[model samples]
Target: MQPVVVPEPDGSVRVAGRRVPRGELPSVVASADAGARWTWDDTNRWYPALLAAGVRVERAHDLRLAHRILRRSALASWPEPDAPPGPWDTLPPTPLTAARDEPAMLFPAPGPGDDALEPDPVAELAVQDAVVAGSAAPGRLRLLLAAESAGALAAVEMFHAGLPWLADVHDAVLTEILGPRPRPGERPARLDELAHRIRAALDAPASLNPDSPRDLLRAIERAGVGARSLRKWELERLDHPVIEPLLEYKSLYRLLTANGWAWLDAWVRDGRFRSEYVVGGVVTGRWASSGGGALQLPKSVRRAVVADPGWTFVVADAAQLEPRVLAAMAGDEVMAAAGRGPDGRGADMYAGIVASGAVPTRELAKVGMLGAMYGGTTGSSGQVLPRLAKAFPRSLAFVDEAARAGERGEIVTTHLGRSSPLPGATWHEAQSGAYQDDAGDDDVAKARSYARSWGRFTRNFVVQGTAAEWALCWLASIRRRLWALGVSSSALDAGAVPAPFAGRPHLVFFVHDEIVVHTPADLADAVAAEVEAAAAEAGRLLFGDFPVQFPLSVAVARTYADAK
Candidate 1:
């Protein structure tokens, strides 16, 4: 039977009406039946300890993640609890981390005058079950919950595995670009030189800091550059000597601060850069990093992500994921056909649009599609939108309806039932104020702009959110395939690696649409094949029998930069 692990006020767990001490929880989980799925209040709180104890769980139902989904999803009519602000309603996710030395604190002991009751995971699970069963689309909601829980597992595992990093290589790259590291609160040599050059070019005082936007803007106006801001694009437009050094300073300054020597020391240890990945952190279901900026690694430092000896990195990313998702969601065969190749594999969707004469060039096709999905009503994108709408009316209409729903302050859901948040009270006020008898033109224009901006948000939310679902399914499938591959291969020896994943290919890094698997060099080819198969399976799981292909650009290399 599946077990529901509920944390007690004293940090013990109640399982099957018997109390399991916190110390023995790992062994109990490890001894459960092979097909058992554990339900818990928060996976991050419980699973990390289980993992540290060398116990691996095959399946889970994360109550916190599910509750967030049900409470916001428009398809589910979740009933409010009898007591206002129940414990489950206010429960927060346990913070994620890469440390594995000890079990996470599951629940704090109530102090004097602390009357808050402990949250009951079993109760929350039952509520979620009822909500899902009585919902408009139970199957889809179930799939979403499962995928979300699986994503949590993947997130913890990736942090445990950690990305391979070569500190020496990273140091060399920084030295080459930033002219060596400097003391804290001091600029690097190259940055200092750039600052001096910028000052000379602007004929400004030496005290003027190039890093300060306000100070730099004042200096630029004093120099008669006629620039409004220090933005790169804005500065590039002006014909002035300060432009080049100023831009270079900004670029190097970002690298020095974001991923320079300081970051290397704090995040990387024992040749691994462990970043805490927060699954479903974004409202659209995309991940966010709690620390170590894992999702924003710049190209300048990618060369430092070197695989271990006798191992390689298999990097794969979906090509044009969102647009292709739109095609499938709208059931626009014309749009889908543009991405389908003669061999039944996927091709460049934008290129296919060009071939179909939807737009004259590939660039225009790309811009037009971006405009349609993102609500770009101006510039070159605007000019090409009409042609695209004429060519693919179904796909265009799909987003148009979503945009219109947002304009009227309606909640729009993704294909898998993750709904966009409702417009705030301020939005309602602005909208209502515009219709008042004494409302002026300014009120009307302000309301119109806010409505359009919100429309843009909802228009992209459906496509982007569905694309995130597709990515989550893709990640879960890849994890299963990689584990199975490791289990089936007898020759693979993980003795040199860490426990729990010693003889297995494991996911080390994941961004929105890309994944990097660190695997044995001999299994690189097989891993590549599995990765492709997993992408196909993800498409099938999300859109059964739909011809919208989720083709990936796969590469196997010793380093991340080389893979690209």
Candidate 2:
């Protein structure tokens, strides 16, 4: 390894005494020390010039090592390996090049045709502002900025991949980060009274008969309350003032449904209400709704959640999960190990990297891997990732194979029946025919090719799909546990039933991957334990030890934010 420093160039400063502009300094010379040799294929007429320069280059069948060296050089501005709370969007596309932003060539050849469309710079700034607004406070803003930026970038990637839903989710996330500022003279409405009524409606069945599922359903319907609509009204009323009327009118409709109340009622049956969720259910392999409103929840109703008299709700989720999965697939061991727990000990698999005195947040690991997996050949993540692969072979191999296949215009999948198909004949013809005739409509041909090429858009569907199943099992399992713990908090106790234990609580809410149980403060621990047990059992039921370990880590807090 060599430490070569090039001083910052001034206007018309020389590189090897050839005048260059400022910000462009002496370039570092590098060589591949291992793996496959490297080669360049000039589709853009750079081959003749490079040959003329007498610059030596080698082409290897597997150019992983040489490729990595080139990748590292591109990542010069990335954060240091030990930097705390590293940038999330480390691989964002650079907009300008050279002094005066003129495009300059570092290599012997001019670059290939640029594929990316120039982004609206003004819109990008507004997006950044929104991220700042949603974050907690001034102190927390910087860290959040990086995360939000990365999320936005990931959304862009998804958009390019033809996944509109994921793009929406990321957009929503951006809005959430830059949360709405407090409106003057308009305080949030009190929902406790409404919460009580909704709880009563939710509880009607228990009063009828504890064990009879039929009686419970009938009681629930008879109550004639629209809990879901009430929730919507409450949330809209608190924030978006204009939508209040529509929200209220919508709730009115729920009150009229013969099956609406019954739907809520059935969910609470058998002393437990379980909802099913589907992950990667969408064509782009993102999560989708199935039996319940698992993807969306109205928060006003969230507070009504009371544990069965004695039990408590326990919640947990993996952090920056997909990036870790991608790293593992890429055979970038440094990244996988960075994302993995040291000796597999804690909730954050990347906790090891943070603990080992490298970057702390998973965002760093995420950014590093994202750059490597995508064609972010010139960024910090690209540079650091190859070294990471060298350290962690098994995991890196996974993502590397995926990337290779992707580069070859191949689709790849996990060890399941779900698979990707290759492009049809139309794509092959467009490539060949366009070159023969001078009247080549490149845009039309590319569009046709893209449609045909969609056949090869493979994903590790097994992991994503099965992961969704696991979430469903967890939701159902915890819902059951909470129902068994129901305790009446109301003085009317009108619809309340006997507590599971002498002082246990009841289950109140079931959002995908999360459960809310309203329990007595003292019994919180016991209730939380039950929730944990149920979640673990759910994972076991679905996967049955098929190599990867799906585990749950829990937190017990007074509020939703606190729990997180």
Candidate 3:
């Protein structure tokens, strides 16, 4: 059964067209069957409130996320082809938190003719359901919508629960590296010393700040170092005393600015680092973070992520997700066989390629596979790609075919039926101009180059987008499995843990293919099994007997840094 939730003026919700009091919403949400999808106007607005109230819904059809998909997807047709977007298109995901770490104001100041509060959510959902049921590939589109909505729920839950953070540990690491956390508005003593050394090496006045690349570049040139830019790679080749301190300065400066003292004070609160997550933010269907640098955090600071006193983290990451996805997508038996480990558990795909004689070495095999999927036609990667094609012809040809179609400006769809955006007006004009009666050779060459560049994007898009879908399926399966593991009464109720996850094992962190679960100490082994089981379930759900394995590198440990 689907519950069409409409917000009522009385601060209650009309659930399934019946008035449900706001205070009683949790019980109503809890009574919803596991498979029932709660159709709402906007999940970012509705779900966060429910999570805060200790209610968690299993499935939902986020009208906002679903509308974006249907309105543009080549697979869906019920909303009418090329329909002009109205108020829906401009309505962005309500931010979970603003940049200042304060709760975001969900109710927006409406623009002229904007009646968002008065729209019939149930009617909109009916239209969406019809579009999916009448789609070119209903099953696939429906699956994609389900998975995307699941991701939306998970993202909000993660933000609300927050990642366990040890502030002292983070500060200690910073002090050890920077020689002490400097006073506010002052540089660390160690960084100041490095700045002095950089200035001395360049034989410049102390006024030339190393932090300013422009000043440092001119100073380095004046000192006869022949430096082009302050980029680390370009600086490393130069044999000069300045290179060492300058590079060190750059590194320390980055740490200081990106995740140093200010970051700690801002992001970490009440021992939980709550980074706002943006579901489906990336075009490839991968997640993107908003406030806090959770997704972009460096491994060095990972030690700060320590579990609670009586709990441990179960960290798991899928091995070579995109490559394995490509294998399953193309039905490449040789590639699929290589995806499994030598022990039949899991294998490094690059290593497996080497074992299959794709190239002379693992590194070459890795580059060759990347080049094929990424559309590299020259360089060392290009040189080794032919051998890889011979070893796994089906996988190579699959991406190559997508690239050709992209070159012709055709839309490419992901495995779960998410269609790629078509080329813009400029692209069509470029291609068309190249065919004009008096077109110049340079125009033709430029058009061809642009085509290859976009082709590369499409080639990688198909594989990456499909990999993202696999991750969604994987996480959704893990979520269901976790919910099945009822909260244990034996352990102390973890009050610091948020609603819905307080007394149970819950997901704390998620990257593209990696996840970390915070679980009670006694349940560590069980959680690990669940993680592996979910990986298998996700694989089966996507490819169903394709023989492609999304094996994980699993580790159970007290600190996140301890995970492999």
Best by lDDT: 1
State the lDDT of candidate 2 residue by residue for 116-234, as single tens digits: 33222233333434433443332233322222222222221111111001222322332342222224432112222232333354554223432233653354345543323334544
| Candidate 1 residue-wise lDDT, 128-176, digit = tens | 9999999999999999998999999989888777899999999999999
lDDT of 3 at 538: 87
Residue 312 in candidate 1 has what lDDT? 84
Clashes of 2: 44
Give the lowest summed-lDDT range of ten residues in model 3.
Answer: 99-108
List candidate 1 segments past 4 Å from native. Answer: 81-85, 98-115, 487-496
Residue 277 lDDT in candidate 3: 82
TM-score of each: 0.96, 0.38, 0.94
Q: Model 3, which residues run further than 4 Å from truth?
A: 9-12, 20-24, 31-35, 98-119, 341-343, 436-438
Model 3 C-alpha lDDT per residue in residues 66-163, reported as the tens digit of each score = 88777778787755465676656656887777422443333332454444445677777878878888888888888889888988888888888889
Candidate 2 lDDT? 0.37
Clashes of each: 0, 44, 2
**TM-score-best of 1 and 3:** 1
- Model 2 bad stretches (over 4 Å): 1-281, 284-313, 323-344, 354-362, 370-378, 403-411, 415-463, 476-524, 534-553
Query: Residue 405, candidate 2: how far off, in angstroms?
Result: 4.5
